[model samples]
Target: MAESKDLLQVLWSGADVLRGKMDANEYKTYLLGLIFYKYLSDSYLAKVYDLLNDETPDDLQEAQKQYEEVMKTEDAKDLLQELRESMHYTLEPDMTYVSILNDAKGNSFNREKLQAAFNRIQESDELFNGLFADVDLYSNRLGTGDQKQSATIAEVIKVLDGADLIHAKGDVLGNAYEYLIGQFASETGKKAGEFYTPHGPAQILCRIAMTGQENKRGLQVYDPCMGSGSLMLSCRNYSTEPDYIKYYGQELMPSTYNLARMNMFLHRVHPENQHLRNGDTLDADWPTDEETEFDVVTMNPPYSAKWSAAEGFKQDERFMDYGGKLAPKSKADYAFLLHGFYHLKQTGTMAIVLPHGVLFRGAAEGTIRETLLKNGSIYAVIGLPANMFYNTSIPTCIVVLKKHREGRDVLFIDASNLYEKEKKQNVMNEEHIDKVLELYNNRKSVDKLAYLASYEDIKANDFNLNIPRYVDTSEEEDEVDIKALTNSIKETNKAIKESNTALVDMLNNLTFSSSETETAINEFIEILKEV
Candidate 1:
């Protein structure tokens, strides 16, 4: 923990120097861009030394001849292996982190050298063509003055040079990036909440989505509103073969879209297996004509937002099957849900976090809810505590949908009370999260926390997926003992009368107010009896 703290301190110093001089949002790009450059440079350095030591002729000509021979064999010159052979690329004479830093000596303080180095890095690898596309060093958000910009760049480079990012693992960097996103969410409040889910609540949702799917391999997973790709990455963490988990998702925000893509690459999810698209998922533009499908679909889309549900979509395959009555344009909660469900494979499962209103709201949303339950697409509803999101205080729920059902009953988990309050935020610790996952796996009825709602019961309620309608989390009013309450109130009234009488007698002996004191005693006894 102390080492982690030290690492953060090292990173923080760079951020602190740029605090008032740079916009908080723009600062992340500079820091993250440098970290990625360091990552690639370290990867390059690690392999070059290995090539120099490999068994070959000490003579440069002989070694060159042997290296060429080695490259011609079947599966001989893989790009990754070749990259390890030398710290070289199709770039101008001097273009690397070391070169950029060395150039930053006296004149490099203004840092045109660093920008040139970044250009070469981006141009060298087609695989990383658009990787740093969003990191704009020339953006005005860094500040208007050259002094401020130069100072910020110098501070950033100094921090990067001081830190040993080469020795750090990708997970460590990814974790730090996630931490920064969380901090931004808190600092930016409502705007940040638009693209972020609190890490703790996101973790609980991820734990639930990932349960019972551990041993699976080559599992296809997706998120409709994949902000920062946190939920999808969490699913990867739960996989027995994490490397085999293929990620797919969509985001409407361009900045968040970039972050999600970077997150996939940062975690080392092969670029080919990642299918993140930047667009409204309800009208996904992925090459779905290929019949691509996912086995796990998890998301926490913006609570309730509007969409066009354009008339052309009436003939589209996804909404066409729902009798052409699109989910109203005012609330597209069910629209996103339907999109995910449509993309889910026959054997797949989907878990979505939504405002609880979806369960009981009337009109178009209610109609869609009825259709899903009646068709047996929904499998469970887990109620979460209020304020689980960063800026919103509204209570929410997770709706679990499945293309295939193992049983006829729907599980209802009333977990609204299973959270600890930390400062002003409600958090679900590992125990609370584990309990929800445990109950979900058992699929059995627990007295209060969980109950299996039969299909008939759900039908009787007109297919309202409201958890309280099924699970009964209403505390039972402490059993309401009328007999005991009456007995206790009567005894309390008699005791009050005796105490008042003693006070009245003492007043009379002092010749104060005998009649008035008696009346006051009677009024006090009557009020006590009413209780």
Candidate 2:
């Protein structure tokens, strides 16, 4: 644990090397790209050292030297082939991060060499085609001219080279990477939503999605708007056979798509098990091949963003089943939900974070909510605290859906008031999350905290799923005692009247040198008596 902390400190300090040169959002590409490069190079060399045990020396420098020497021989061809098949990418002897760091120390570093290394990695496999596109080493944002750019890149490389990622455990390195991503998200503020979900809500979504699948084998989990793959990764924490769980996701942003891929690799998720794509999730349906439906689906899409919502979309299979009415072009919240729900298995569960407006809004959304409620697809609705997310402070809710559920009741939990206030955002502690999960699993009404509303009950409210309508979380006003309050006021007034009389007597007894002063004192006493 101490070693992991040290590694995280070293990696985080690399930001200082480029703090003023670029924003955290921009510099994140450079920093994360280099960390990924180091991880790849380290893993490659470590594997080679393990394979060439008798022939290679044990010392780090000596092992690297021997590995390079071996790579120059004809034997390197077979080793490269095996590595490519196993790791999905390969690095040349000179393309390793250690080699670049050694060159930088010798003042022989150039941005072109680093650029070429990135190009080589991209060309190595389809998964890595555009992996390094966001990291522009020669960009003026790093520095003004070629010399400055080269120097700045070299300095960042030096700072990262100090961290021993190869010696660290996979979870250690992955945790540090996640830590840096979170730090950058904090610095990035609202834009953080583009690629990251705050840990609190992410865990809640995961728990809700993985409720009954804890002991199941070969469980498949997916996220449609998989920002940085944090929510999908969180599901693995609860899985009994995490290694067997297949992960699938689609991200809209290219940079974030690359981050998700790197995040998966850093966490030691097998390349074959990870099926992440870079594209708009709602622009078109995905996974065109086999395995359309997933066992568990989770999403935290952009709240109420506009979409084409073209008339042609009514024919799309995902939307065609929802009657002729489509989600409004102005708000595509229901579009994202339907897309995810369409891909959920009959026995699967889905948990999505959405704006509160979807609950009671009439028009097209109301029709969709009514359809879902009648089918018993909406399982549980959990109201999270406001400001729990980095993007917007507006309170959001997580609607848990289970297809073909036997129960016709929908559980509503009002957890909006159950959060710890921070300096900037409200946070849901473990107790808060566990309390919600406990109520959800129990599936019982808990007075003001939770309510199990039947389909008949929801229909009575015209299919409005507003949480407050079901779970009354309103605090009771204190009861008042009018008679006691009136008596207290009368007693206080009597005390004031007695004090005024005493003051008047004192004023009358005092002798005043001037008639004006005596008149003023008498007038003051009269005013007190009137009060």
Candidate 1 backbone overlaps, count? 0
Model 2, range 1-531, lDDT digits (tens) per residue? Answer: 899989988898888898988789999988999889877877777777777784433445555786799988999999888778876777777877778888999999977777787888888888788888898887999888988889999998989877887678777888788889988988888989888888788888999899889988989888889988888988988998988889989999889999999999898898779899988888888987968999999999999999999989999998886657788999999999999999999989999999999999999888888888888899999999999888899999999998898967899998998899988788888998899889988989998899999888998999999999999877899999999999999999999999888988888899999999989998898898788
lDDT of 1 by residue, 1-531 (tens): 555556566776767666775566666666666766655554444443346465323232233343345446664446335663343343232444544555555446645656676677667655455556677766666667777667666667667666555555656666666776776676666766656777656776676666677778888888878988988888766778888888887888877777787677667677667877778777654537554677888888877888897898778776666645777888888788888888888877888888888888877677777777767888888999898788688999888888766555789998899899877678888888888888888888888789898889888988777887877666655687999999999999888878766765655455325879777766765665454
Per-candidate TM vs. native? Answer: 0.83, 0.94
RMSD of each candidate?
Answer: 6.2, 2.2
User: Which candidate comes out best when scored by lDDT?
Assistant: 2
**Global local distance difference test of model 2:** 0.87
Compared with the true structure, model 1 gives a TM-score of 0.83
